[model samples]
Target: MSLEIRIAASTDAEAACNVLRRSIRECCELDHKNDPAILDAWLGNKTPQMVANWFSSPTNFSLVAVSEGVVVGVALLTGAGKLALCYLLPEARGQGAGKALLARMEEQACSWGVKALQLHSTATGKDFFAQRGYTDAGMVRSPYGVETVFYWKQLDEDTTCPNAPKRKRFCNCNSD
Candidate 1:
């Protein structure tokens, strides 16, 4: 089935949060042997209030991929050009939904006049980001005892959307 991409609304908070939680769990399980308590702490810290704050924040932008009315993937962009909370359901992986969601987020960042984008990618997603022109910046150890690789991509000047405003600081709308 073809995936549909759209801007995420406040209504998507629960599904988006679920997707992120699952993604983190799956990725960590595949790569690490961390205890349940650490995993719970890392993913459990986000609450409904935080999700609401993300939706209301001006500096944050979120996008989702839906299939048959169900959200299968999500991505969030922050004012600092950081990409966060990017995830695709286990069933949705390897079917282009992830790439589509990422493209849209990059487009949004470009529209916001962001010069660069950064993210910390899991072992599973590291190659995916590298294939899309992101370079490794460093490695970060998670509180849950997992090590993630940091990556960054500098967008070309010509890729900036003409309609985006020139602003230094904006709202922080990151998820996860």
Candidate 2:
């Protein structure tokens, strides 16, 4: 099935939260099968307020993936080029939605003049990001207390605005 990607609206908060929660559970099941405590920490304490704050942040840009009119994936960008969240429903796994969402978020970051993108990935997602050109920076403790692997990707410089001054260009050319 073809997935549609678009900027998430306020109405999408609930569905996005559901997708995130399910993704966490699925990741734990697949990658941390022997660690129940870790799984609990990863999926246990999410609240609507946190979800709302994530979507409402001025620095955040969230995209939702829809298939058959249902939200199946979500990706959020923050801290300029930082990938704050990326999740897909279990049923949507292995589909192109996750990659598409990540690509779109990278595009968004580039448009905003960000030179690099960073993210802390779960064990399940670490390999996925690595396959997409992100290099491991180090391991960090996620808010959930699970050790997440941090990754970074340097973006290509924006040459389209070569004649324009660096400060005025859409994407930072310095990071290239």
Candidate 3:
């Protein structure tokens, strides 16, 4: 897959949501199971309209991973140093898309002088974040009863992973 990472636009919301839905429903199934209610509640904010709002919001920034012209993954970062979301479709995982998306998000964060990054992760995703240097801050239950684990990483000059490649695949949409 030829992957490119770029800043998301309101127009990309539908495709981004597609990736988010698949990621949450399949890739993170271990966290939500087949419980319809849980899936419904957990995925409520993953709609295209909501994603579009993220694109338009001054407090949020989003990135999309496109492979061969399709949006296969997404990562969202907040102005307050939160990694609001980072998700990839199953087929997009294990092929460097996640790392690229995250690296760019971290780069953007550090560019803004953000000193820390934090996120809530599923049990399935906790290790992935940990491997990239996020320290676990323990777990918390969501208002909807999902047990989500919290992870935090103090940012510095060397916070980025050595394994992350130089971003040579940025799309023109990257400019704000």
Candidate 4:
């Protein structure tokens, strides 16, 4: 089945939280290493309530990828140009969900006049972000003791809108 990407709503809190937790626990074995302590710390704040607050925040733009009526991916970008969250179910990887979500985030940042975006990527997501033009700024340890790669990307003045089925200028862009 095809994937549908759209803005996240407060109603999506539970499902989005589930996707985040599962993605971290199951797909990020490299980072958590099946350590219960690490897992707990990493997932401690991923509750539905916290996710609902994030979705309701005016300073954040959240997106979810849904497949077969289930949310399979979740991502959030803050107004300060921080990619706060980007997670996908193990089954959702490599199906363009991540790429689409990142592209939309970049476009939103550009619309807000943000020049650069920074994110801490787990081990499993390092290559994925790097391949999408994010460079390693450095390595940092998360609050949970997980080593994460700090990634930075400078967005172009005209960020392409990947949400469209065809590659075209975003609505606000001047058409050629």
Which lDDT values do the candidates have, in the order given?
A: 0.80, 0.82, 0.87, 0.90
Query: How far out, in Å, is residue 131 in model 1?
Result: 0.9
lDDT of 3 by residue, 37-82 (tens): 9999988888999899998899888899999999999999999999
Model 2, residue pairs in steric clash: none
- Sort by TM-score, best first: 4, 3, 1, 2
**Candidate number with the higher lDDT (1 or 4):** 4
Residue 121 displacement (Å), model 4:
0.2
Question: How close to the true structure is residue 110 of candidate 4, measured as C-alpha lDDT?
Answer: 74
lDDT of 1 by residue, 1-176 (tens): 76899988888888877777777777657545567776776677555557656866888998889998888988889999999768888888898998898888888888877889999888889999999899998999866667889999987654434455545667699867
Weakest 10 consecutive residues, lDDT, candidate 4? 158-167
State TM-scores per candidate.
Answer: 0.84, 0.82, 0.88, 0.89
Q: Per-residue alpha-carbon lDDT of model 2 for 96-163, expressed as tens digits? A: 99999998888777778778899988888888999998999998987656778989998765542233
The TM-score, computed over Cα atoms with residue i paired to residue i, of candidate 2 is 0.82
TM-score of 1: 0.84
Pick the TM-score winner: 4
Candidate 4 per-residue lDDT over residues 1-176, each given as its tens digit? 68898999999999999999999989999999999999999999999999999999999999999999999899999999999999998888999988989888888887777778999999999999999989899999999989999999987654443332333546876669
Model 4, which residues run further than 4 Å from truth?
Answer: 158-176
Deviating ranges (above 4 Å) for candidate 3: 158-176
